[model samples]
Structures are given as structure tokens and as C-alpha cells.
Target: MTDPQVEPAPTRALPLVIAPPRGRQKPPRHLADLSAEERAAAAAELGEPAFRVKQVAHHYFGRLERDPANMTDLPAKNRDAIASALLPKLLDPVRTMEADQGTTRKTLWRLFDGALVESVLMRYPERATICVSSQAGCAMACPFCATGQGGLQRNMSTAEIIDQVVDGASAMANGLVPGGPGRLSNVVFMGMGEPMANYKAVIGAIRRMVAPAPDGLGMSARNITLSTVGLVPRIKQLTDEGIPVTLAVSLHAPDDELRDELVPINTHFKVAETVEAAWEYAKKSKRRVSIEYAMMRDINDQAWRADLLGDVLNAYGDWNWVHVNLIPLNPTDSGPMLNGQVFTRSRSDDMREFVRRLEAKGISTTIRDTRGDEINAACGQLAATE
Candidate 1:
């Protein structure tokens, strides 16, 4: 595959906010935010018996019930009080749009502070997956991403993050989605914000997700996929955390020169360094790291670039440690920051050639299925409009 004679797009300067701004009011506390010991202490503080908290946990985490009115086993008099203190609503659904005959639902949620975020629930024959947001908006300033176009509002609390999953689970269990009563089988942190940026809260949410049914969701860590835009330090930290969640690095470009413009954070952490961290993570966790490359018409979709990407990943030895997932660029109207540039999805032939180049180097690759296109299923599109 020869390099095509295509002129590179001119780079433009955009403001980037790597760190979230300070002094934003935190979201209300919820039971999902606390440990078992903390929940019992909270129950005692609320003038309820310790066992009451356990029962509530069973309802929330086990039964996927959020309304105090539905908790019939608890004493009716204390249900409201206990619910008010521990199960305060974190996400208020502003709007829900469905696609694929209602099997895919994208929800726009407003937090307590009125900051907007979005999540998506998709059902398949074999499994159900929910893509949850970790923050209100994004700070990465990835030029083509809708979430990054709107700067970071604030970091979401752990409970706020967990509520998205819980709500999705409730929807599935209640048969609200197209499939009749089913359980959520997987979760992906690929919506709205960078999961690694909100490290503490994201980790807390994962802990609650993998804990036992009475205390947490009891979902397998392998079922959760955490995506990052190559935050090297956080990737290393996650590798050391001993949690075996799948890691996905949003590596839009194989070279630092292009990545610096596509992903502003690349200016600090080069492509080699970021890939190294992901490689190290795969080695330690014994889990394959997914290389997420968004195919943009001619910008980063050249056949030569695909070969370069293969070389880059194979440099660390092709022990099946990495797999490439090519995402078709979702359509978004060009905003001011884009300098009147519109990124189009790659042509099917070009994409095929790109895949061929990678496969030639023995790199495992798969093209991601783009779902809910009519509902603007891509992260931050609905929230940004709202």
C-alpha cells in the first residue's frame, strides 16, 4: 500500500484544559459512594438500624430498585428517611432518544448542578452494554470530539458515575428497552470524558461495580472497558491497581506530529511514550490493550499511516498484547475551533486497505460497529446540543 498524495490538513490552535477547574459544588452523596462500613455508619447517623442499610443496598445493587416506594420489605415509615439520606437521585434524565428499533437508547442527563452528560444503552442478542460518562464534559480538547469542544464543566462524583449504570440496569430489568427483561452484561467508559482524568472517582465506581451483590454490582472486571486518551501516568497507575479491566487508548494517529494536533495532550506525552505505557499495562495485567484509532477520511486514514501504526505496536513484540479498533468518525458540524474543517469518515476501500496494511504486519484489528447514528450516539453530541 503506497502513501497517497494527499495534502495534510492545516493545524489550528485550540484552548486545552487538562485539569478541571476548581470550586464547583459536589453532587449529593449516595449509597454507592460509601463502603459497607461507611454505609452502616451513615445508617446509624440517620437513626436507622445497621441492617436497614444492608437491606437498602440489596434493593439498589441487587434488585436494581431506586424508588423508596418499591422497597416493600423495609418498614414503610423508615423507607423515605433512609432513601432521602442515602439514595438521593444523582442523574435526572432530560431526554432519551432511541435508534435501531429501540434497542439502542441514548440518554441526556442533568446532574444536580445542571451540568449535562450523556450515556448510551445498547442491547444485543448475546449481551447488553452501557457506555457511561465519567465527567460532565471533557478537557482533552481533541479537535474532532464533540465532548472536548465543550470544555470541562467539572469532575463527576463516584456516585454520579455509578447512577448511570444503575439506571441502565433498571431499564433493562424492567424491559424498557427492546429486549424483554435482561441484565446489563458489560460497561464501557468511552462516553463524554476521559476516565483516566477522573482517576479517583472512576476507580471508586469500578470498585462498586465489581463488589459482591449486597455491596456492589458483582459484575466482572473483565466486562468493564476503560478508555483513555493516552494519559501515561494514569495508565501506569491503573496497571498497578491490580484490577484487570480492559484498557483502550484513543490513539488517533501513529506519529506524534499528527497526534499533537489531533490530541492536544500528545504535546506532553508523545505517541511512543503513550504506546509504551499501554504495552507495559498489557504485559502486567495480561489483558490485551485496545488501540482505538478514529478513521478520518484523509487525515489519519492513509495506508502508509496504518503500516506505521503496525510497526509502532509490533515494536514491542506482537505477543497478541494489542488489538486495534478502528472507529468510523461520527458526523459533527464544524464549530469555530475547527477552522471550517469538517472531518469525514474514511471511504470503505481506504478502510479496507488500511486494515490490510495492519494485518500484513500481523496486528489484530477490528472495525467497531457504529450504533445509534440517527440519535447522535457519539459521546457529548446530545449533551452539547442540550
Candidate 2:
């Protein structure tokens, strides 16, 4: 079959070497950032009745309402003031592009300080999932990721992270997309940042997502998945938090030699140590850990590598406690440029063989369906360009 005719993604010239951002803009306080007690205290500080906090929380989290006018539970005079103070605008939509008949939407957001981040909302027949960023850029300088090329600007506040979910939920609730009014079912921290790097704020955001309404969005903890690039210590810390959100480790390569080049942090935490940490989390949390491997043609997609990956994972735990998600790498700016990124995508047969090899080893694996590639849907591509 011939490939569909589509325009090539415009390359935005960027520094090959990533650099730390010099300055950042501070976003205003958001209600999601506060605890139940903190929200009430904040309301009191604004000279509003304590009950006002619940009313606002109900509007934002419960009803997916963000506009002050829709928050009629609060007095007309105080609604605007309270909403403005507690729920200040944190993410400004710079651009929105939709694919898959408008069921898949990718949004480019500009934070208060002019820093750029991207999120994706994908609606299916049975579920709607949103991928949100936890940081402005990214600190993990993975050579094959657009965000890694940009480097870290700053860590996003809890409210900023939660606000992305609220936006996705709001979009689903209002029938703005192809699917009529729906509820967001899944949230993934698989966008620009390394979620574990922003540990505290990301945890706070997760709490706000799973906490009962008036405190959080009230989504099931199981529906949330946090992806990390093998942050060994942080993974152990998360096990103690008692939140059962699925942990996804981006283990691009199974061996230290390749992993050190693919995921630079491997230099600090070797592959064996990282997988061991994930196994510990799975043992304690009783949740199946997801191992994410992005398949690149001839780079890490060799059949022997697949067997090695299975052996490495098998050494830690059984199949029930772990699963592998093999992603056919998207053509991004950071992808190999010798003959353009066309060579970056692993062939279907190669991916299938890779999955078969893993499953044959009594390990479970699945190939991830690529989405939004036409619009440069891979994390930082839009932000880096637009």
C-alpha cells in the first residue's frame, strides 16, 4: 500500500545540545494545588466564606466547570473574585490540532512564563485518555526524543499538571470533540517531562486526580499511569506512597551499553538495578509494571536484543507482574536524520517478530498503535516548532 500524501513536519532549527532554561514565569495559585484544609484556608484568606471552597471545587473537579459564570452555587458577586484568585489561568492554548476524525486532539500550551508544553487527548469508543506533561521542557536528554532535545525549563506545579487533566475532562464533558459528552477515563504522564523527576508535584497531581470530588477529579487510581525513565530511587519512594497507579519504565534497551546511550541516566542506575526497583514496586503495590521500549530500525530492534530484553525482565519477576509495550518509534526531529526520519519507524514485521520473541519467553508484550504522527504528535515536536 502506498503511504498517504502528507506534508513533512517543518523543522524548527534548535540547538543540538540541550541547555537549562535561564528563567521561568510563575503561574498563579490553583485550587488543585491545595489540600482540603489548604483550600478552605485560601478561601478564608480571600475574605470568602469557607463553604466557597467546596462550591468552587465542585465546579472545577465535579462539574468540569472552569468559567466563573457557570459556578452559580457561589454568590454572583463573589464567584468571579474567588475563581480568579484560586483558579487563575495557568495554561494558555497556543494551538490545537486534531486527527483521527477529531477523536485525537493534540494541544500546544504556553505556560504563564512563556514556556511551552504539549498534551494529547484521545477518545475511543469505550475510553478517553489524556497524556499530560509534568515539566515545561525535559531534563532527560534522550537523543531520540523532541522534548529531550529542548532540555528542562522548570518543574510544573501540581496545579499546572492537574489543570491539563481538567482541560481534557472539560473538553470531553462539553461535547467539543467527535464523541458526545464523555468522562475522561485514563490519564498518562507520557508527554514531555520525566514524571519522576518532578516527583512531589506529580504525586500531588495524582492525589488530586484520585481524591473524591471537591478535593480531586475523583478518577480511579488504577486509571492513572506514571511513566519514568528508570528513576530507581524515586520508583522505590513511590511504592511507599501507597498510590497504586501503574508504573511505566521507559526501558528502551535491556543492556547497560545500549541503555547508557539511549537513556543517559542508565549511567547512574544500570538496567538491572532499574528493573529490580520496578520489581520491588510491583511486589509492594501489586500492580503490573509496564516496560516501554520504543523500537527503532536496526538500532535496538534486533531479534537478539528482544531475547536479551525478555531474559532481563524474566530475571526480576513473572509475566503477571510486568508487561512490555513496544512502541514503533515516531518520526520526530530528534530521530535519525541521515535519510530523513522515514528510517526511524520499525517495520511491522520487525515489531511483530520482536513481540513474538518476548512472548515466546513467557513474557507478555504488545505493540502500541501509533497516533497523531501526521501532526508531529510525538511530545515536544509541536512546542519546539510552534
TM-score to native of every candidate shown: 0.95, 0.92
Model 1 Cα lDDT, one tens digit per residue, 224-277 = 999999999999999999999999998999999889878899998999999999
Stretches off by above 4 angstroms in model 2 are 1-25, 332-334, 337-343
Top candidate (lDDT): 1
lDDT of 2 by residue, 1-386 (tens): 00110112332334422234556556688988887788878988999888888888888989888899988778888778999998899999999998889988999999998889988999888899999999887777777777876678888999999999999999999998796998899999998888998898999999999999878889999999999988899999999999999999999899898888677888889999999999999999999999988888877898999999999988975548899988877764433342243337678899999999999998889888777777777788888786
* Candidate 1 Cα lDDT to native: 0.85
Model 2 root-mean-square deviation: 3.9
Cα RMSDs of all predictions? 4.2, 3.9
List ranges where model 1 is wrong by over 4 Å. Answer: 1-14, 332-341
